[model samples]
Structures are given as structure tokens and as C-alpha cells.
Target: MVRQDIPLPDGPVRTCIGCRRRAAKRELLRVTVGPDRDGRQTVVPDPASSAPGRGAHLHPTRECYDLAVRRKAFTRALRLTGGPSSAPVGDYLDSRHDDDRPHLATD
Candidate 1:
């Protein structure tokens, strides 16, 4: 008898609102919109990608983040009440830009 090795099936893919590319879900970060304790709009990271409210996916690149902010992609994707406005999500992304740690290449 001979044993054979087979690669496992690739997981589901998600479209990045920033780069407009289809990539594996794991390679993208999920952002969700919710209300704070005072009911004010708030955006948060959805690490598990299973948040209940509206969600959008973004690549980790700074360029992608800028594109999304410029085009208001997040607001549209999440059907936000208002158009693109720098809020919690934007602030979070901005912080990531200053991160000195190197990112692992997905390709």
C-alpha cells in the first residue's frame, strides 16, 4: 500500500473593502459597529469575525486603511447612519499604523 498526501481545502474568502481584493477571511481584520453604553455609535475590532452588528473587513496595510477611510467603505458596508466620519474605527486603524512590529506576509 502507498500513502498519499493531499492539501486541505482553503477556507472561505472575504472581500477587503479597502483593496477590493478577495482574500482568505483569516488574513483580514473584521470591524463592527455598535453603540456605547450611552448609545453613541462606536466601532470595535471583531477578532472572531462573528460580531452581531454590521461588520466590514479590512486588510492590515496602512494604505488599505486609508483607502477605506477615504472612500467611506466601512460606513457603506455597515450601513452606518452617517457617512464616513473619523471615529473609533479610524482611530484604531491609525494606532495600528504606528505599530513597529513586522507583519507576517499572507502571500
Candidate 2:
């Protein structure tokens, strides 16, 4: 009793730690808490999505990123203590030109 109406699924689904919205893995960016050169745990962007350890997903826009920071979502999602720095993720998003706004379609 298989229904053929189910549309083809996208890739893996992940929730934006910021906006808390579910989107395909390809549509979101992955970040993880990793040790920096100083040996301190910091939230870093995994653009290639190949980093080890647990990872958190987020939209690559300042809005979502800011929302996550406002709500302390990173600490909870990454089980971080002492407020690990998230500047890396912020910088990565800044370097990218695609804000990924919900609407305002360009194409």
C-alpha cells in the first residue's frame, strides 16, 4: 500500500539553531564547537560539513545568526559552557554575500 503522491524528498533535514526552522541540510550551514589555537572551545562554521563531533545548523543570514545569539541557542545546542565564542561563525556568514533572506526572491 505505497502512495506515489509523496514528492521526492530533499536531502537531510536540519533545524536552524537560530530561527529554529527546519530546512534541507544543503539549505543550511553547519557549525560546531571546536578547539581554537588557544585550546578554547569555540563555535566554528563547517562550510564543507565534514567536521567531526556534534554540529549545529543555522541559516547563513545575519537575522538568524543574531536571533540565535540573543536567545543563547548556541550554548544549549552545543552544550557549551562559559559562553564559547561564536565570532568564527559570524565572520563566515559576513564573508558570504548570500544573505538567504526568506523572501525577496531574485530568481
Candidate 3:
């Protein structure tokens, strides 16, 4: 018996609001916009890429996040009435940055 190479199904590609480039869904982060009980705008991270609301995709980088925030891409993409919280996004990226950093020994 011989094994032959088989092509897998191609996943959907979404454009990043920050970089404005098309990339695989797995290669980007999904953010969803929802309304609170008081009708306040809320941005939620949808890592699974499946949420029951308007979504905006973005690259998982501080630079990209900053660019998106500055351009208000998330609002435009999600047709939101308000902007997303940059602090939470920045903090999330900052934590990831910290995890990638080398720890110093303090004996």
C-alpha cells in the first residue's frame, strides 16, 4: 500500500484591520463588539473566531493593535458606535511581551 499526499480544505481568510492585509483566520485574532445592558459598546476577544456579533480581525502584535486603535479600524469594521478599550488590548499584548522576555535571576 502506498500513501499519497492529499490537499486539505482551505480555511477562510480575513483582512486585518490594522495591516489591511488578507491572512488566514488562524493567523489573526478576532474581536467582537457587543452592547451591554446599558447599551454601552463592549469589545470582546473571540479567540475561537466564532462569536454572535460583529467582529474585527487583527494581527496579534502591539504595533498592529496600536495602528488599528489609531485608525479606529475596529469601530469601522464592526460598525460600532464607540471605540474599543486600548488599555485592555495593550495590557494583553504587554503580558505576552513579558512572557517572551528572559527572566533575570535575583539570588
Q: lDDT: which candidate is best?
A: 2
Candidate 2 per-residue C-alpha lDDT over 9-85 given as tens digits, one digit per residue, 9 for 90 to 100: 47887889999877788888999988889999999999899999888999988899999999999999988777998
Q: On residues 16-96, what C-alpha lDDT tens digit does candidate 1 reach at each position? A: 999898778899889888766677776666767788967888886778878988887887888887754436666666777
- Cα lDDT of candidate 1 equals 0.75
lDDT of 3 by residue, 1-107 (tens): 52356332379878888988777878888888755556677665677877887788888888888899889887788886656554555676788789999999999
Candidate 2 achieves a global lDDT of 0.87
Pairs in steric clash, model 1: none
Inter-residue clash pairs, candidate 3: none
Per-residue lDDT value at 58 in model 1: 85
Candidate-wise lDDT, in order = 0.75, 0.87, 0.76
Residue pairs that clash (backbone atoms under 3 angstroms), model 2: none
Which one wins by TM-score: 2 or 3?
2
Off by over 4 Å in 1: 1-9, 36-38, 84-86, 94-107
Q: By the TM-score metric, which is better: model 1 or model 3?
A: 3
**What's the CA error at residue 31 for candidate 3, in Å?**
0.8
